[model samples]
Structure formats: C-alpha cells, structure tokens
Target: MFQNQHTFHIPVMGTGHSIDTPIRVAHLGIHSVISVVDDLLCEKIRKHYCSEFDLAYKNIPRSAVDGRAERIKAYLETVHEIVTRKFQEIKELPLFEGNEKDRYFNLLPGSNPLKSAYQFIEHLSDREMRERLIEDLNNKMRPGSIDVNIMAKVDALGTDKDDQPLSSEYSDASAALRGYANSSLSSSLVLSAGFNPRLYSYISDFKDFYRDTSGEIKKKVILKVSDFRSALIQGKFLAKKGIEVAEFRIESGLNCGGHAFASDGSLLPVLLEEFREKRDQLRETFLPMVQSFYEAQGWEYPEVSDEQQSPRITVQGGIGTNGEMERLLTEYGMDATGWGSPFLLVPEATCVDDFTSQLLANAAEKDLYLSGVSPLGVPFNNIRGSGSAIHTEELIKKGKPGSKCPKGFLVSNTEFTENPICTASAEYQILKINSIDESADTEEEKERQKNKVMEKTCLCTNLGTGSLIRLGIMKPTYGRQAICPGPNIAWFNREYSLDEMVNHIYGRGESLVPEERPHMFAKELVMYVDYISELSLLTDPGDAEWKKLVRMQKNLEKGMDLCMEIAESEAYEGENLESLRLTVEKQRMRLADIFQNNLVL
Candidate 1:
C-alpha cells in the first residue's frame, strides 16, 4: 500500500468491465481491483491475453475436479505475469517522451513525493550523481497491486456433471476464493456485496491469511462494507478465525454501481463519521482473539505495533471530481479513495466495447437509473439503452421474455419449480406469469406484479457479454452487454485516455464533468430523499415497514443537518457547496410530503 503511487484505486465495476484492469494499469503503479465473480469470463480473457503474449493456452474444462478454482488461478497468474513484464519494460526504458515511461510519471499526482523527487533528479548538475539517483528511482518503482473482488452473496451452490450437489467448498464464491488463495500474486481479496458465513469461515483454511514469525502476510483480506456495524461484524468473524482484515473499504450505499445496497437511510458522511470515531475498535476488539487463535496453532503472532494494528479505511461512490476526493481524504482521514464509474469511460482502464462505450458516453441523468432488473432482487444501478435492456424489452414485446439461463450462477428461486432456478429464466418467468394472471387481483395490480416478475434479466451471462465483445471472443452482433454504472456516469460523456482521467482525478487538468454537477454529498442526499419517496409510495406500509420508514426519516434529517453545517462552514472552490445547501432545503419539503401523503405519520 505504501508503494502504491496513486491515492485512488479503480474498484471492481462489474464482472467484466474491470476484469482485465490490472493487465492494463498495474504496470503504471496504479492499483485496481478485478472482479473474479465470473471465472468463465476470466478464462476467456486469459486465453486472449495468452495468445497476445505467445503464452501457452490450455483449456480447463468446467467438468474437471475443482475446475473453477484452477481456471481463476491460471487467469490471475497470467495477469500478474503480464503486469510484471510491462513494469520491467517501463523500468528499463530511459526517461523519454512519447513512451510508456513518461506516461506513467505524468499520470502521477504532481504533489506526490516520488514524482517531485523524479522531477528534481532530472535537473541535477552532476552527471554521475544524476545517473545514480535515476537508477535508484527506477529500482524503487513498483507495479501496482493486483487486487481481486468476490461478491459473497454470489456464492450460489454448485452441482456436479451428474446434477448432484457438490460440497460447499465448490460453491461459486468458495471456488473463487480458493483460486485467488492459490494464485502466485501476493495481493488482497476484497469481499463485497455482503457477508457469507461459510465464505468467511472457509478463509481460515488458507495459511497465507495468517501471519508468520517474520512480518510478512502473503495474502490479506479486505471487506467492502456499507456501514461501521457491518464492518465490525464481518471483521470480527474473520478475526475469530485468525484472519486479520487488511482494509475496510466503505462505499456509499445508494450512490454506487451494481447492486445499490441502500443502507437504512444511512448517509455517507454519517457512516464515515461512525467509522472515523470507531476505527480503533476494529483493532481493539479483534487482536486478542486473533492472537489466541495463532497460539492454539503453535504459530507466533507478530507483536502488534500501533501503526500496523489498524486496518486501512477507504471510501468510494458518486465521487466525480477532485474536490470531493480531497474532502474525503483530508476531512474524513480516509487512507484511499476508489474512483469507479468515471474509469468506465477510460477505454485504457476499463473494457467497454465500442457500442456500449458510446451508450455510456451519451447517457444522461435520466438514462442512468436505479433499476430492478437484477435477478438477485437487489436494486441495480443500470443504464438505459444498454444492449441487455434493449434485448429484454424486445423479448417482452415478442411475448417471449426471460433468458434461456445458460450459466445459472444466479439461480436462487424455488417458486414453481422442484429444483432451484433463476427467476430470469424462461421456464420460471412463464410459470410466474401464469400464476400472476390467474390471481384474483385487479388488472392494474396484475400488470404491476407481472412487470416485476419480467424485470429480472439474465445478469449472470449478460454482465460479461460486453467484455467478450470488446475482447473479440464474442461478436458485437450477439450484443446483450449489460453495464451497471453509478449516476456519476451521466456526467462523463466521452471516452478518455487513462492519462487524461488520472489527471482529472488529481486536479492537474480541466475537470471532465460540468461545473453545475452537484457535489458528491449533495447528489447522495438527493438520491436518498428520492429513494425514501419511492419507498413510501410502494405501498401503505404495515406497522413493521412503517417503523422502518420513520427511522429512515429521522436518520435523513440528521444527515441533512450535517450537510447544512458543512455548507455554511467552508465552501470548497469547485465543490458546489451552495447546491448542497439548496438540496437540504429541497429535500426537507419532499420529506415532509412523504410523511404527509405517502407513508403513515
């Protein structure tokens, strides 16, 4: 982490968007996360890169024993090899323009001490001294960390070729973990989506997760959480098994891409405040338990140092400008920030096919929306006019909705079927629609219910379709490319080079978004208000649901008041603090309306 030259990292965008990001950016000393959620996608990408590099390509059949783990391991090793090769090439190159070496240095923040030291060495008078410094700088250069992400909830149980249930270790998430665990790269595993008790407990079997007598951890675990409570619970679980959490990556609940795990009206600032106050509790609560576990195994646990005890805290979501990032880092004391959606526009960073890339560029605020298309029943942040959306709509028009369910990684439904199936599968949807039509509900209610049933799209296969198209493994004609970008994608309207985007993030170049775009905090507040309004209108809440709504209202007011204080206090140059002030007042009135007309008082 100290060696990472960049203060921000590219988070896992989707199963495919950033699957190969490490191969693209790691050589530049920029850390990024790859989604290992789709091993088949990773395998295809592996074969593609292997052919490009003239490396041997062997097919690992899905029916082979523990093939999912092996496939992921081989692909990740290939990515690590490619990234190392590129970094060595960059190190060997002389300081020159019109080359990757200059691109790497120029992409770094000018305020970075390494960049400053490199700049200073170029102007030195003594030739021998200058050469020595340059050599030292080159030697100190390190490739960025190649982190992998596993959505814990995506761990659907797997079956063998005989259609019999396999052991829990062969589940989707478990296999991905085993692959990453056995990989040659020494990196971190980011556990996102949600916690799986089995997955957390299984991590104990890997010896790399434990610390040795010498101060070296081959593999560290990072938990991507939405709130402090979740962080504590998940961290404590991992700690009980002798696994120390390397970092806690906090994401904005409603303002992120993919599945928007909206907290119960918990705002980003409020969550960050809780983490900031209780950051030490993570180390305090877990250390003794972890030490005891190590002792039971007859392994010496490293003496805890104040500096090494606490896990690193990072924040990401809806951050489109440098001013917001500066506030997150300086004000909240975040160790790092994650820039995700904006990187989707950087072809040099993310893998978006030409057609999908154009769709992302032309996407307006209205085009990027919170959709209910995910088969997992979570609110998915989606874009309008994506190939998958278009395909789904066309299928409905033809009276044949739902996919054929090729790769059933998301299968969880048991309704109307003996065996579990994906709700988005044709067989399931047809049966569900039949049941909805015969119900005694009114026409309007039936239509609404049917819409909900049909809204589930085949995300398992479609999510990675764009990457296949972009990588030339699949044709664009078979376009069913699904993209899940946060609302921030609406502000970035064009493809950008990797260097240009990094320059924007560091505030070294002109801003990519419009000046009128609201501050990240302001946008989040507005979204929460809108989300509450939507929830209130969903139905007349029962006592239980009504109580939840009331709690949300109170929590929202707390966040609004805090935003008001920040707005009245210090106004950042381009942070649009005034808009935040306006949003607070505007949402107050809307919140009043929800209480008055929608939800019960």
Candidate 2:
C-alpha cells in the first residue's frame, strides 16, 4: 500500500555520522538523509563512491565552512554527473538483459538491491565493488531515479554568532535554499527546524527562479515539525507564499537524536491523533490560502491529486521495534517511520567509528543524556564519558577552557567583543572566566557557571571527525569522537548489517531490540520527568519557570495517560504489559513528585 517503495527514511545523523549514509542505504532502494553542514565532508563523499540513487542533504544555516554554498552546489553537480555517467555505462553491459535489465532499472521490490548488487560484483573487494557498480549503472533507467535533494534547517530564532572575522557566517539558510533553487536538480527540498517567515521569503525566491526556468515549482516542499501546531503554522506560512507542503515530518522531542527540543509533555501518539483528527481542517485551511496566493501572483495553481493535496504524516524518534513501526504506520495512519539511531549501529549505512559503534552497542540507559554541550545553547543529546567530554574536562583542569575554534559552526556568542565569538572557543572562555564577578555570587553558583562554560565541546569538528578518524582518513584534533545516538539506541546491543536492520523494521526475522528497555512512549515520559526534576533545582524560580513546570507537568500527564491506553489496547496484549505498566507508573510518580516537592512549596 506504499506509493514509493521506501516506507522508511534515515534522519541526518551528525556532520559526519551519516555523510555517505544515503549512498549505502540507496543501494537498498531506501531513501536516506545526509547533513551538508560540512562542505569538506561533502567533498569527501563525492571523492569516495559513485551511486545511482537519490541522496538527501541536510543544510544547516550556521555552517562556517569556507565557500559553503558554492562548494555544496559543486558537490551536488559532481555527484549528479558521476551517477548519470555510471548509469549510461550499465545500459551497455551484455549480462544486463531483458527482465534482468528491468530488475536493475527498478531496484526497489526485491530482497535488498544492495545485497544483490554486491553479490553480482563479488570479484571485487566490498569497497571496490560498491564503487565500481555505482560507476557503471545503466543509462536507460527512469529519470530522477538517481538524484540528490536538499534540506534546509532554518533556525527560526536567529543563528548563533561568532566574533572571529569571516570565521562564521551568521545564517546560510537563504544562501543554501538559493543554491539548490538555482541548480538543475528536480529532487525534493525539505524546510526543517521551525517556520521562519524570512526563510519563507527565500523559498519564494526559489519558486520564482524555478518558475522562470521550468515554468512551475517542480520541487516539492516538506515541512519538518514536532507537533500539529508546528505543522499547521509551517503549512499556513507556506500557503501564504503559494506553496503546498508535500509532507509533514513529525519527530519526538526528547526521544530523538541530535539536539533535543522536548515538547511540553506531548506524546507522539497524542500528536499523531491531533493530526489525524484535524487532517481535513489542515488541508481546507491551506488550499484556499495557497490558491489565493497563486491567483494574486497571476499564476495558474498547480493541480494536485487527492493524495498529494493532503500532507503525509510521518514519525521518528525512539522507534525501536518492528511492532512499534507497524503500530505507527497502521494504528496512527502514519505514512512512514524513520529509523535513525539504530542505523548508526549498521556500519554500512552510517559514518561511525568502530570504537564509537562498539560503545553505542554496549551503552546503557544512563550513558545517553541531554547535556548543555551544544554551543547553540540548545539541549543536545550527548553520550556520557565520550572522548570529547574527557577533553573538555582535561582542558578545565589545565586552566584552558574552550576548543581551538576551528571550523566554527557553533560560534554564536558575543559576550566578549563587537564580533561574535563561539562560547566553546578557548579565547572566549578565558575572557568569560576573568570577567566573572566572584564577590557578587556564591562560591557554589560561581563554580557552576564556570564548569558549564568549560564543558562546551567543539561538536562542529568532533561529530564529523568521528567517521574520518575511524576510517583512518583523518586524525582527531580537538578530542576523540562525540556521538549523538538517541535513547532508543540503548536497546540495540550489537552491530547489524543493513539487511538485518531492514529486516528488523519489516519484521522479517527475530526482534533485534533487547526487552529490558522501556517502551518508546514511556521512555519519553521519563525524559520529561527528568527535565522537570532538573528544572526544580532552580533556587529563585521566575514566572517563566512556573509556566514551564506547568507545561511539562501537563504534557507528562497526557503522555502517561496515552501510555496507559496503549497498554490496555488489544495491539499490545501479552507484549510485556507488566513492564510497560511499571515504567509508566514510575514516570507518573516522578512527575507527581516534581509538582509536590518542587513546585508546591
């Protein structure tokens, strides 16, 4: 019942985590998203393998790499040419005949195309064979089968600034959108991070440019949101600009990898229900606005089929089991489910070092936590006791706080000068330490702030360098690798092949997930409770603090209620209902304790 053969997508890992992730997964006829924040990393991917499937690139606006826009555009063009040329050669092969040719042309419906493709070229080493096969695909294949798409992660709340001259570009949201807009590629473009009116204007520019060239907006716009409100907000914003969002991608706030933006206690199931209930209202609200915009612009509105008019609802974050995937797609009416952190364990699909992969496979629940490690001041999902953490602590011990500030993607602090500097930079940290008013604050308070500053690691380099170091392509400069696997990863205790991982998603084999971990919904509730507990420690709570507590409390209760409903539902019968119930009750108690002990007094 799937329109496209791919019913799953791999979310963008880190700078290097999923650099060439798409190349590997695409061989399985699965769509994968890659981060283009590091243009250097993009170049590395192009230099390595040639592939004959679509690769999605996630463009972060705060990226500070040199010639970032041009470099990305060039990389896209280079890969496109490589893939196109390879396809042409494959068409001329003698063995590629009749139905076999058709099979190669249409690679999605069989037992993983990647597996078969590799077996077909078994004479060459695994690495060499993949490279050769990618470089020799048949040219007569359907157009757009092998292509690249762009994803823009706009920081709705302006990007962080750095003080170094030309060291960091404030925001490349517009630049990235414009580059892809000007490109000849017809792959889809996704606008992630929340809705930004200014970014929408850039999207408008892309529409105008594309219309001028192709007489229409051929590329589809996808909005990545965490909840229904966000989806509606983004959809309405794009509708005002005469754009219809092709899809609404929903992610779990705390359950996700990378920077965690915990929704105020709202559970994934609840959010999905809201969308399903109001699915018609969303389209009704959007269609008229888009039609009006199109009419005002003197352009004929593009006709969309019944299915295309309504945005597809997809969910990601903490999805561990095939059962969970099925429930999400069937019960929630979700179009597709994203398999992210678990893919990190599959070395074939992600750019993780052997050491880091082993660490991830063996990690416990406590190893993954939300930390203030991101220079962006966001709550980043971090691996505890990582090399980056050790390096940060060592720097503090040596009286040196902050990293060297190379590749300053996170440079957005300006506490020291007119030019913004990175909070994680050694120069800024030293200045900040000297400026601290020791007498004004208590010793404990002063030490707390000092430690926080010292703990900021250079994720810009560490995240991307992990894979490079693992492959012996580059040496670690600032520290060892820093990984950002979601809490769901704790349940997966071993490295898996791409075939095995895909099988796990489709329920083709025994479950790969360990049973000890809490259900995905309950795990999220526990995270919210933990966040509330952390917030309770504030000595002088403000009005905003109280409101945040209330929000968290309300959401946690909502989530707990939903978990109970799931437990009672027939779908989960005999599936460790006792464990699920215990986990939910434990989180419920934790939430209650936060309100009674911390807020009540």
Candidate 3:
C-alpha cells in the first residue's frame, strides 16, 4: 500500500562543505527526547511526545489487571509486542544492514520492564505469528521513531516528602504510575544528577539497581554536573558506582534566569579551562567511556549602543560571543554546545552554512571599521547590530519598506523580533529629508522629521516587551520541553511558537519571571553590563575601546550625558530607559541608511 514511500531526506544544513562548522549543525538536526523530572510532568510530556510520534499503544487485556505487578507485566507485554512486531519486520525489509538492525533490536533487562516483555515474546510458540508481527512492527517502528536520547530531570528524582525514590519506591499514586512507565519503557531514563546534587549521595544504590537488576539493558545516564571541578570529582565517584554517564552540562556563564548580562564579557575562559583540564584527567580514569559536554548558552539583554562596534563580537566574558564553540568542537572534539538562544531567534537556524556566509560578511564589515576587531565581540554592539541585521531580513520578507540588511538579507527582525530595521530605515529617511542641503538651518525640521518617523514605526513602545507578549519571544513552550532563562529573546528567535514558549516559561520549575513593570528586566540586565564594563576597563586601562565603552556606559547609566544632547535633545526620558534608547536606535539606523555602504570604509 505504501509502495511509493521513500525515505524523506531533510537535507541537513551546515554540513562539511558549507560555510559554518558542519558537526554543530548536524547535532542540532538530530531528535532530542526528554523526560520531565516530576512524574505528573513526565506523563504530560510523554503523552505529547507520543502524539507527535504517532506511537500506537494498547490497553492491557481485561484478564491481566488483577494486581500491580500483573498490570505492570501486561504493559511490558504490550510494549514488547509493539517493539518486537516492529523490529522483526524491519530485519526482513531491504533496509536491513549491520548497525541499522542493531538500533532496532533488543531491550535492557534489570529494573527495566521491556526486557521482561522481550523474554515473554521469546517464549511465543507461533513462529509464523512472530515473523508476521516482526514485519508489521518494522513497518510501524519506522526509522525516525526512536531518535531522541531518553532524558530525565534530577529535581523530579528520588523520594517525595517521605524520602523515597519515585521509581524505586512508590509512596504516592503518581510515583507508582511513573515507576511503572520507567520499568516498561524501552528508552533509557536520563538521571539528571546535576540538578539534584543531593541525589549524588544515593548514586550507589541507583547504579546498583540499573547494573544488577537491568543488567542486560543499556543503562546509560546523563549526569548534569554543571560545576567544572565538582563534575570531575563526582564523575569519578559515579564511575566507581558502575553508572555510565553520557553527557555533562557546564553552567558557568551569564545570569539567564534574570536574563541579566554578565560582568565578564563571556566568562567562558574560566569554565573552558576547567572543562579541558577535567576532560584530560577524565580520559585517564575512564578512557574508553563516552565523554560528552554541553556549554550552556542562555539569555542576556541584547547590547545595542552607539559604540561603532561589531555585532556578534566576542568580548572578554560574554557567552555566545566568540568562535569558542567552534574552537571547542575542534579543540576537545566534544559532542554538543547546548546552544538555545541563537536558535530561539531563528527556528530554522539549524542550517549554519547558509547563514555563515552572511555572518562572515557582517563580521568582516565590523572588523574593518573597528580596526581588525570583529563586530560581534564589541562591548555594547550586539543588541542592535544583531537585531537590526536580523530585523532587516524579516522586514523585506513582509514587504515592508526598508533597505536590506548590511548582508543584503531582510529588514524586519520579525524573524526574531519586531521590524526594528523598518523603524530605523524610516527615521533615517526622514533625517535625510530634513538635511535639505545642510545650509537650510533645518535642525528643527530634522527633529520634527525624526519624531514623525518614530511614531509611525512603533519605536515609541518597548519592542522587547511587545515581543514577549505578542510574539512569545524568549519564552518557552510545552512542546519545546526546554527550560531557559526568562522572557528569552534568543529562544523566541529560535522559531518556538508562542504557545510552546509560554508553557515552558510559566510551567512548573521555570526560574524566570517578569518584574511587573516594563524595563525592570532591562535595567537589571544593564547593571550587569555596567559591572562587567567597569571591571574590563580597570583590568585593561590602556584599552582605548574599553575607555570608550566605560564612557558610553556611564552616559547610559546617568540617562545620557553630554553625548545625548549632541545626538538628539529629546533622547533622555526619566522612566523607561529602553523607550528612550528606542529613539537612539532609530537615529543610528537613519545614519546607516545614509552612510552604510560608505560608512564602514
């Protein structure tokens, strides 16, 4: 019936020959399966995931529901029946190859319930039924069916208020239900040891159960040890306990919760050094074991300023600033970057190669203007520079009036935020109109022109706040199933639906919250930037650019100083600093329109 069916090859972007590093892009395209730490949460997420996958499930036969163990056993039988039927058919199919079949076969024994199902299926007397089931199962199992690594949250682990591991001991009905699923499900449960550091105290018992009880099953676990040194020490302890740790997450940079900027540019050096040292030591202790690491990239206020700097530039301590990820990939040969922000702003951002060419061009422009320094790494350049470029592309796509971005992309930022480019472009056009041969003494005309342009572009409102409510930017959704720092503009850019972002944003265990006032978060983020700027200036007193940054920050802190009057008289407003800056952004955009082509030169 499905004769015409062919494997749908979603052309993976950012591969080897393309512009950006291929491996990083490839890692993103792969499916990531996750389990919530809370039992109730897990059930909700599981049901949604199952629906997405179209996995077929059956109720236990009426005769099999007399007891808890029997009920559990019946579930195992059903899952086994489902998996076995699928695998047998897959094996006989033309697609069957060496490891291709391996991925489709078997179940871990131990506390894992799938093994029992496998064993029960093994005893079936009807070979014809088995073969038929196998064929049917393969057709149903499908290739992309089990791609995600099974994940579990640590906060949801161990005993409830009564001190009992939810899976091992069931004091509550919710725990009981989850434990049943854990036992029957074929996917490995990722024990997030990092979230619940206290769980490490009980790692021995948990490891024993997985190793001894489910000896035949693949007992892989993701140990989320974020602290670099602590992870190394705990990793050793985990190894001794016989648990196979899959990946480690390093949470060393930026206050993504408050979504605040960092005091250090990226502060990655501190953690990267530790990661390198630990990985080297770890290899000596566990040579053949699979070693994995993820660099946490969360949120920060987009840095927009009048510094004539580069966008996407890596400053001293900023996260997601440098080619650190690329460097790390080549240097340590790591697995993933745990990058969530850049993708949040651009959902189809998985293909890095397509964008890398443009990024290189943008980087080059900044490099030339900033005297060989990349724009992306500049102090306050990122916020508007990156947003403006992205916004420009989105605007053109919407058929809005604006010049193309510097890279000739779009002009809306709607791909990630509102059409800041349109606003900027319009304001700049007005400014030019007012100039009128310069000898006309038209400063009043220019001011009027700028005001008219600002109102038309919605530059008067807080773009960031509007983005949060209107577009669900920097928010989390139920389906995305990832918790990130609050009102996350980066995640919003990643193409996450408003509904999905909202779910994760307000969902249980989320750490970020709005301040009940506009620009509250922005102010906090600015303070962090100020702290970092001051520190950098102190350390590198001789840095001319840094001195300029300190001057700019002080002006921004005091609601604008002498420069504000020179740029525009009405730039300073007591309340809503972001609102005042909106005008400044429009002015900058206007300047770009008049001079962008020749401006960098």
Candidate 4:
C-alpha cells in the first residue's frame, strides 16, 4: 500500500458552482466518461415537466425498420419545433409576473441582461438573431437519434478525410451563443444502443472550443452510458483510438425503468461479472485491430491512450449498504465509485453523517426506499434519490405547473432527546453500545461496550470517507435544460433530498443548504482516508503518526474556518447561499489540510 504521490490534473472547467458552467463536477482520475447527446430534447422535457419525458408513444414503433430513420428524424424535427414554440412564448413573458421568467431566462447561458443590449440589438444580424432564437429553442429540445457515421468521421480526425463530417448551423449557433454546446445528445438510439455518434462531435467541439473556452471558463462534459455493454465496447474502442480523454465511468445500480438496457432485466452483478471476466479479452481483441490499422500507415508503433493504459473505472448509480459496497470493492478491485443516485440522495451517507443514522432508522421502521430510475434513482426514500424515469414520470404526471422546484419537507432540526423511532433511539443506542469508557459499568458489559463503540466509530468514519477516494458528481441536467433556475433548483431539490432530511437535524433554514457540499465533502474525505490507509499499510502502526495527523487536522480546520468565514463575509455580506457554503466546505476538508501539512508524520 505504498502511497503513489502522483500529480493528477483536476478538471476545473464545466464544474463550477453555477448551472451556467459545464455540467460536470469531479473526476475519478483518467477513467472518466465522455458524454454525448443524440439530441437536446432532454432539455425541453425537463423544463416543461420538471422531469424528462419520452414521446415515442407518439412516434412510430421502433420495430418499424423501413422508415425508422425518417420517423426518428421527424420526431426530432417535431421536438425542435415544440421547443422553439415554447421559447417563443417565453419571449412574451413581460406580461407575466413571479419567477417564471427568471427560470426561463436562466436556462440559457447568454439570456440575462441581454449581454449588453447595445451589442445584442446592434451587431447581431437578423439571421444570426433568428438562429440565436432557434438555438434558444433547440436548447430545450432533445435529439431523437445521433448519426454513428458522424462519430466515425470525427473520431478518425486526420485518419480519415474521405468520410466527410457533417456540420450544422444549429450546433454552431449553440456553440457561438452558449460559449459551448454538445455535438450529440442522449436520444432514443443512444438509449437503446450503445455509443451515440454525437460523442465524436462533443469531443471535437470541446477540443475546438477548448481554445476559446480556456479564455472564458473551463467547461465539463458528463457522459452517460445507458448500457454497460455499449459503454464497455465504446470505451475499449475509444481507448484503442488516439483520444486524450479524462476518465471512464461505469455507472450502475440505477433503476433505469423500462426504457434503458440496464433496467430491462439486465442483472447488475451478472453484467459486472461478465465485463470483469472479458475486459482483458476485449482489450486484446481491439489492440491488434488498432495496431493493424496503424501498421497500414507504415507506422511501426502507433501510440494510443490504451498503450499508456490510463483507464479508471468509476462506479456510479446505486450501491447498497456499506457491506454491499465493501463486497463490490473487494470483489472487483474497483478503481473508484461514482456515488450517483445514492450520493445524490444521501450525500453524507458516504461519510456516515448524522442523517445516515436517521436513514438507517427509517429503513428499520419501513422497507428500504430506493430510487425508481436507474443512473439517477435509488430505492431509498429518506435518501431522496430517483432515477431518470421516475423524475420524468413525476414531471409528466404532475404536468407543467408542477415542474417547478419542489420544496424540502419541513422537519424540525433541533436535537432529539426522546427515543424517537427513526433516529433518537438509534443514536442513543449507538453512543451507549459503542462507548469508549468502561468505568462504573459491569466488567463484561464495559469491555464489550468500549470495543463496540471504538469499532463502530472507526468503521463508520472509515466507510464514510473511504467511499470518496474516487468519486464524481454528475449534474443529470445540462445545456438549455438547465437554463431555467426552476429546474435547476428543482433538480437539486430532488437530488439532495437526503440533505433536506439532514438539515432537519440541524434546524437551520431550508434555503441554506449547499448544493455540492455533501457530495464534494464525501469525495475529499475519501481521498484523505485512502491516502492515510495506504500509508499505514506501508509504515509501522503507531499512535504517533495518527495523533500527529489528527492534531494537524484540527489546526488546518481552524485556518480553513478563518478563510471560509472571511470569504463568506465578503461575498454577499455572508447572506448568500454560496458564500455560506464555503464555510461548511472548510470544515469538511479540514482533515485533508492536516494530512497535507504533516505529510512526513
């Protein structure tokens, strides 16, 4: 367990605090995802319903192979038209009042304050404005399908010029207006098949825009693979190809409903085992094929990213309890875990937060509640996680008016003295049964209690932080879908339901929650735990190092608190939500600060 003190690049682009930034946060080393969209309809469905809705029932049957392509394309055209109309209505919002306009306005990147009315009205041509208007409309629309030929052409780059890549004014306009837009979208084809062709477009656009975006803001792209089989296949191909990608994520444990592959009775453990068993074979199979392709170019050795082999597996979706998680890690030797729905629902569960105890209590009283949607949903009610389907269904059921952000359930936050069935009793028992001191207790009982307490705390602390060693927070919503603040807050409201449950324990205001805190904190602590655990394996066991580390951590917390307080106080006079969150994060990562300061110890 030697500590590999290697310097890895942290992607700071597209992962900012605001929705205006790219919709990716955190990366599990080089093994990350490169998300591509089939179309942009996902955005519109989200805005109108506060969830995603598929209108395939209205489109022709998928079994109809003859005109499938045309039908799908027509569906996309309809989506574009619908989204355009919706946006046009938004333009007539001056007559309405309340927060609706703000939501729609915030949905797009360059809508507010007109980006200088003089520049907007003066320089922008009528055609550019029309395209901009359409871009705004298209922002809400999701793609019905993506062209695979386009991906081949784009991924090939200089490798193939005979296969010309198609460009669209829509994508160009989107890029121009939003600073960046995706090349493809998550459409029916990508949902049904693996590897949307638009991924190539995204890669190319990102590469091209990186030059321009670097000067503006770093953007992030969260790649979603609905099917693991497809993801693995596409991943192998990408690795074999010469592409400088950041990570490869294996998203699992989601209830994808009836639409996606993983959810269509595709056993999780079986799929995982199959991939684990065949990964090397797949790699081997692809390596020679790529080599032969390169050999044809008279290149003795063409270097692919696969040659260097920088692929980190990111475990996302739904991983059950700590025991289940431990088993997955020990079984697969997983590189990292992306706590998708679980992290979204119970962010602090990764760290065994106070709310975690409450969730355990609720689970004991009631059957475990999991999200209905795969990738996004979980089966844990107190955790407040949901899958894409559930969310979309909820939106569809609730209708457009119901699409607004849902409010956190109002629960008292003060400490509990009574033996509440859900939490108080559990905490008391946990503290009592796990006590460290044995004085005045029956000898046998005292000894057991002391051991239990120590073991439980240690395990909880370890499990809490250990989970974060490799984690990434992926915003399920992106682009025009995120333009409106309504859906943004709404998405978080659903995503961070567990936080709401935890806030009840703290008794603070509802609006004070940090959007990224629970997830980010879990990630940072996990890194700290892994680092320490690895070090302990290599070095002799002693309290000197551990105690020193703890002491250093306490000191770092003080400094972080001071810095956070100053920053918070300066920004919005400490009243703003973002400003206050900085304070909480300081306390969360205080452990890392200590370990870094006393590295030699």
Misplaced by over 4 Å in model 4 are 1-169, 172-194, 201-228, 236-241, 244-248, 256-262, 288-307, 342-601
Among all windows of 10 consecutive residues in model 4, the one with the lowest summed lDDT is 479-488
Which candidate, 2 or 3, would have the higher TM-score against the true structure?
2
Which regions of candidate 3 fall more than 4 Å away from where they truly are? 1-33, 44-181, 184-198, 201-217, 255-266, 283-324, 342-601
Give the runs in model 2 whose Cα sits over 4 Å from its true position. Answer: 1-3, 47-66, 82-170, 208-217, 437-439, 470-472, 476-479, 539-542, 572-577, 599-601
Choose 1 or 3, whichever is better by lDDT: 1
Count backbone clashes in candidate 2: 13
Error of 1 at 213 (Å): 3.0
Candidates ranked, most accurate by lDDT first: 1, 2, 3, 4
Residue pairs of candidate 1 with colliding backbone atoms: none
Instruction: Score residue 248 of candidate 4 by CA lDDT.
Output: 41
lDDT of each: 0.88, 0.68, 0.32, 0.30
Model 1 lDDT per residue over 73-146, tens place: 99999999999899999988988555888777777887777788778976798999988888888877888999
Q: Indicate the TM-score of model 3.
A: 0.35
Number of the predicted model whose lDDT against the real structure is largest:
1
TM-scores for all candidates? Answer: 0.98, 0.83, 0.35, 0.31
- Please give the lDDT score at residue 579 for candidate 1: 83
Q: How far is 588's C-alpha from truth in model 3 (Å)?
A: 25
In model 2, how large is the Cα lDDT of residue 486? 92
Q: Backbone clashes per model, in order?
A: 0, 13, 58, 53
